[model samples]
Target: MENLNIGQHISRRYNEELEDIRNRVLAMGGLVEQQLKDAMTALEKRDAGLAAQVVERDCEVNAMEVAIDEECNRVLARRQPAASDLRLVVAVIKTITDLERIGDEAERIARMVSTLVREEHSTRLFTQIRNLGHHVSSMVHGALDAFAHLDTEKSVEVWSEDRLVDDEYDSLMRELMTYMMEDPRSIPSILQAMFAARAMERIGDRAGNICEYVIYLVKGKDVRHTRVDKSG
Candidate 1:
């Protein structure tokens, strides 16, 4: 491992601090991923208790967000880091926000799962819902993997994968719309499905946002506010 080169005695402390921040961000990402898994399992099993637990654990995610933020702020204020250190700190700040939002989306999906358990749904719709979950979950995992590895190519790949999730969401909506049009009784289940799909779509959006941050962290460029010109 390379030393921080801040004179002699304090280099170890600096290295330790940086490593701790990275680990904390990874831990937060893991927590959000686990929350998504728990939410999906609860939906698949129709386990209200597990769904409620997911909702309750969202507070832990929020706390992790705050802690990460504070650590990043401290690093910036104390170290006055420049170049890659600056990029890493900024990336952690942005990435944690994305992770926190993903956690919220997971909780939202869990609540919808509870509704799905309460309401009766046709077999076909249930199968489609499961398939949608699988896609969104893969996107989440891909986004996190891209971030952890700092692979800009993988991040861009994940960003493009958002299109597939959006297409699936639109298709699901159209199917539900047809069901609602054909039978008025299907409206309630359709509404729940719509909310669930919307939540999953938002999760994909946030995952893309995380991918953008990975690009920023690696390349030291802000890809969020402006469009890139490829023809130059």
Candidate 2:
């Protein structure tokens, strides 16, 4: 799937560095994926212990981002990669940034479970939020897969998933606002849920952003803004 051959370099060290950094990016992706899952599970199950773990593990994500970024910088300084190699380095740098922010969103969602007052969520509210969470989770996975393979088609599909995520977010937020307005007593708890959902929505956006970077890396197209309405 990948057009750029990472192992084609003359310097064995250069090839190893490129491959190692790619692996690190994937490892970071896996970590963020787990963080997102744990955070949503914590919210849905009201498991404070698991939520605390997610929050504490966030530092590991930050550290991975820093390490991979340093590696990318070193590759740029020493190898001075040109053509596709250059794009690969640039894409790795951008992907890790989004992954770190995704980790932050997960941490924020987990915090809501521990810090917010306990109020039983309405069935409808929980259902909508759960659906949104699942959709964003899929998008995140798809984004990483697209990047791993340099699959522009897969990247575009993941980018389009953002529209569905946004619609769900809007629907969920509207319901939450209505609930809050109807019962002022539930305002605090519902607000917490709303914020968590907002974080999930942002995760979807970031996942799509990562897909855009994949397209940039593969097709050399800067599609971030113009690709917003893309579905085909």
Candidate 3:
């Protein structure tokens, strides 16, 4: 758990602000991560109470995002940070945006759980989606770990992992299509499952995006839309 030691400054207050914002980002990341876990558990267990809890926690996620944005704005306006400091702020902004989007996706997944549960879909049917949920859950968690350490190497590891998530999602879609073709009556519930799976896939992508931000924060290079070597 090595930090990049990014927040040091001559002014104590300025240093505190930067450190505070970074810590808050991690705290928000923690909350979003928990929301994702709760959502997935709710989906798997068909627990409407837990699903509702996930939806309710989304507002807290929203509030944290708003507060973090304001803190970044204050830093930008007052400090006018440059070089690595500016990049750190920029990366924080981008990371939080993705985290908030991930929260939204989790909320979407939680909402879809009720529909899938109502249909009483078999556990065997959720095979791919559940697999994907776990995959992306690890993706999201790895991404945060990388950010906490400011480790570009780990970031690339998480970045390259997105490929597997995509592959699994495609497989899930094909399976759902086959189910719909074989039994027309399953289409409605299957479509709900498909939507939930899509949300999981997007969550993986967002986790990759956070890794990109981590790389940018460390190397000062924007890696968006670029191929991250899995061999790295």
Q: Which candidate has the top score in lDDT?
A: 3
TM-score for all predictions? 0.89, 0.94, 0.94
Q: Which parts of model 3 have CA positions greater than 4 angstroms off?
A: 1-5, 229-232
Clashes of each: 0, 0, 0
Give one digit per residue, the lDDT tens place, for model 2 in 1-232: 3467688888888889999998899999999999999998888887889999999999999999999999999989988888889999999999999999999999999988876525665334555588889999999999999988888889889989899999888988888999889989877778788889999999999999999998888766778679443332
Candidate 3, 99-161: lDDT as tens digits: 999999999989976776667554556655788999999999999999888888999999899
Worst lDDT window (10 residues) for model 2?
A: 117-126
Error at 53, model 1, angstroms: 1.1
Ranked by TM-score, top first = 3, 2, 1
* Stretches > 4 Å off in candidate 1: 1-10, 225-232
Worst 10 residues of 1 by lDDT: 1-10
TM-score, candidate 2, is: 0.94
Q: What is the lDDT of residue 181 in candidate 3?
A: 96
